[model samples]
Target: MKKLLITGLLALCLLTQNLLSQTAWAEDANDSVPLKTVTLSEWEAVLKSHQGEIVVVDFWATWCISCLERFPHMVTMSERYQSKKVRFISMLLEDPEEPEAIALAHQFLNKQFLNKQLKGKNGLAFDHYSMNENLMKSFEVLDLLGIPAVFIYNKGQLTHRLTGDNPNKQFTDKDIEEAILALLKSS
Candidate 1:
């Protein structure tokens, strides 16, 4: 009986050690996946890097009612077409150089956000390089630029550019869905 009890305790100790070692190994592996604020270079790299994938880059702000309103369509499109190499990235252009826009974004998200539903809990990725003039040029937003600018890049080439509040000033859920599908089809 004494020998049996000792064997059981030994087995339990070994099992516990094995479980902890597996968890530690998994954590170490997962630590390499970078989730930091992506720079414009990094965003561009991701956009231009994909070989056969369609990347939908949305230039939007938290303050833009038109931008926020189209988010449900964005999320829906993301989920609906996630399996077909469709990458949706919504980036915020919050510049220290443009304090007024940032302040307006803050007020819009805070003071009048329907108790913070539209702003999202964590908010958009604001550190992208498009905030820089050079990066903006790289994005090809020089002469004809507009808020909530959606660029559909297929196979690293600019395919479709949808500008303004749905371009025709008639933003609808169907338009977003169709745009996303059009981009995905090209890939």
Candidate 2:
């Protein structure tokens, strides 16, 4: 009985050590994933830099339930349209004053990337940006009342703006995919 008790305790200690190492590795991996905070002007500059290419800008927040639900579809879309040169950009809308919100966004993104949601057939396929201004002000500047908004651009021109402003006009992943296909066909 004494030998058995000692073996059990040793096994428990080894298990705890392994778990701690895995947690540390996950934290380090999350920290390495770059999440850039950009102002509206800086975001515009990013769009301009990608001029002449099809761009899909997804605006979401870590706290938004609908946004989280639709994020996986966005990842799939990014992979689908990657070969067509469609740039997928995820803009995380969070209060810059709230460090915890920023941290949560990082955690959310880390999980997505680590789970292979953000990876394409080739590799990583999305650009991530966090809003660097007040949440309400950022929404106002973007002319949006609420999020889970996706803006599709073609040749640097605003093409389709998908939002959930009205109950009757809410969009789905299929709608976004159709819009992207239309833009690609037109180009």
Candidate 3:
């Protein structure tokens, strides 16, 4: 009986340590790097890094026209509310190794996106960040429905999503601002 209790105690201690270590490991992996969100790889830790804060994640593609149109507002909001509780991230949905496509991506981002919010991975890690077409579809973020297809995550739950490229039709920065404020207050 004495030996059993000792063994159980040791097991419990080990379990607790393991849980703690797992939590720390996750955290370190997420906050390992920081910058304006741009690439899919950058978003690998996004959901993790933005814990306790509001995260608006935009899954876009260079070929996406709607994404281009709405890119400016996203970048502006990211910079404007940067000091606040919200963090905005942009991830490309296309493959990076395709030199021609990537070049086009860069040009589109520079000219149309205006390089505002966050561009990540520097090159491409679309698959690494699980932003592939299938993955996006799994997350319900796929389909050529729109650009700047933004999802607002509050406390880890998707609170709102805007799935369109037409700025004239989708939510504006003002709308985003209001949503973030309200969500943060309620949370």
Candidate 4:
């Protein structure tokens, strides 16, 4: 009985060690993912750089209930439509003055990537931004008056904007997919 108990404990130790190793590796991978910080001028430059491509920008905030609800769907859409012509960017509408908000946004992104919710060939290619009021105004997201807004730009021109009247309304992956398909078909 003593020998059997020892063997079982040894097995458990090995299993625990393996689990720790796996968890460490996942954390390391997530740590390596770069989340960029861009000012309004930098953001405009990025937009200009991708002039010929279809850009989908999601305007969100960590505290926004509607944004949180729609984030998973946006992740899935980014993964599903990974393409050279189509690019996905997430603009976190957090005040740049608040460091806590930026840190929270990074944490949320890390979790999303670690869980494979944001997986694709272009998943890591997704650019993240913490936009100030100026940036928000430049993108016209402030006028929309809500989080979880999505805008599609074709060849540097604003093509479509999806903003909901009610914050409780959740936008589905299919809704974004349909918009992307229509845009692609047009070009």
Candidate 5:
């Protein structure tokens, strides 16, 4: 019984240490990178520049648990469709009024881009973006209650909108992939 207690206590300590290290790593990652801010018009210009191709716009935030939950699948989808004529973009929908929030959003992007689970295994990532009020209004963001929302654009036209955690409804990988495949076939 004493041996068993010792082993369990050791395990608990190791687990606690691991969790602490992970938290520190996250904080470090957030502080190590700098992110830029862009206006709505500039964001639109980016979409316009990518016209004539399939663009997946993912609207997410650093504080959103649901967005974090759904992020890996999106990353996988990005990797899967990378060879096709599809472009994946992650748009952070942070507080447009808070500069600190915007900075945190960029740090979150840095963490994601450097994440071993998302990038190390596949070596795949997408361009990161942050959206302002004008951009959100242009994208009709008010229509939705929560994110992470995904918009599929084809040739500069909004084609599909996928939302996460709407009354317990979340999009699956198959759902997103089907949309991309349909768009590719259409183009």
Candidate 6:
């Protein structure tokens, strides 16, 4: 009977240790990265704040496979244009009301090393924002109807709107790069 109790106690201890370790691992994964929630008005204010600078805003979501696939290219563009006056911003379109969605977004960002890459290490500062679902739906000013959209703004003016709405006329990363190059040359 004493041996049975000891064996049970050992098993309990092992289970407790395993649970604690898993919790710690989860916390460590997300500890350094945080998703900032923003309303539509706040998003407008962010754009207004960066008036004179060229802003490249990539609208993406965790569920969009194309967005995820194209994200690395945006990061590469951000790194390549680090010496310029362009600002790369990633706007995550997720339901802020859902905690799980927000957590998943953070996990994705961390996995992509987005937090580290966009930390303003060298030249241009990068911004990451998670838009509320209602705000995202109401954002008609951009006339955005799809994911994998990139809006390029120069001197507070919308210069380019790249979207994959049309099946045949989809935009590519090279197109985005060319737009930025043209803008840079003009400035």
Considering TM-score, which of the candidate structures 5 and 6 is the better prediction for this target?
Answer: 6
What are the per-residue Cα lDDT tens digits for candidate 4 across 1-187? 9999999999999999999999998877656445667777777887998898889999888888878787767777777777545788888887777879878887787777665634433445466777655545644634666767888899899887777756686565566788889989988
Compute the lDDT for candidate 2.
0.86
Q: Which stretches of candidate 2 lie over 4 Å from their true place?
A: 1-31, 115-124
Candidate 1 stretches greater than 4 Å from native: 1-39, 97-144, 165-171, 183-187
Ranking by TM-score: 2, 6, 4, 5, 3, 1
Q: Against the true structure, candidate 5 has what lDDT?
A: 0.73
Q: What is the lDDT of residue 142 in candidate 6?
A: 50
Q: Candidate 3 residues 43-162, lDDT tens each?
A: 546676666768877766667676676666666776666667576666666653455665555455555333323334442211113243343453443344545567788877778776
Q: Each candidate: what lDDT?
A: 0.57, 0.86, 0.59, 0.75, 0.73, 0.82
The 10 consecutive residues of candidate 6 with the worst lDDT sum are 115-124
Candidate 3: clashing residue pairs, number: 9
Better of 1 and 3 by TM-score: 3
Instruction: Work out the TM-score per prediction.
Output: 0.53, 0.80, 0.54, 0.71, 0.66, 0.78
C-alpha-based local distance difference test score of model 4 = 0.75
**Superposed Cα RMSD, model 6:** 4.0
- Which segments of model 3 are wrong by more than 4 Å? 1-45, 95-97, 107-144, 165-170
- In model 1, residue pairs whose N, Cα or C atoms come closer than 3 Å (at least 3 residues apart or on different chains), thus clashing, are 40-129
The true-versus-predicted C-alpha distance at residue 58 of model 1, in Å, is: 1.2
TM-score of 4: 0.71
The candidate with the higher lDDT, 2 or 5, is 2
* lDDT of model 3, residue 165: 53
Model 4 scores worst on lDDT over the 10 consecutive residues at: 116-125
In terms of lDDT, model 6 sits at 0.82
Model 3, residue 57: C-alpha shift (Å): 1.3
lDDT top scorer? 2
- Residues 71-175 of candidate 6 have per-residue lDDT tens digits of 878877888887896898899887667879778877777766644555533443566788875645645755788888999999999999899889998999999
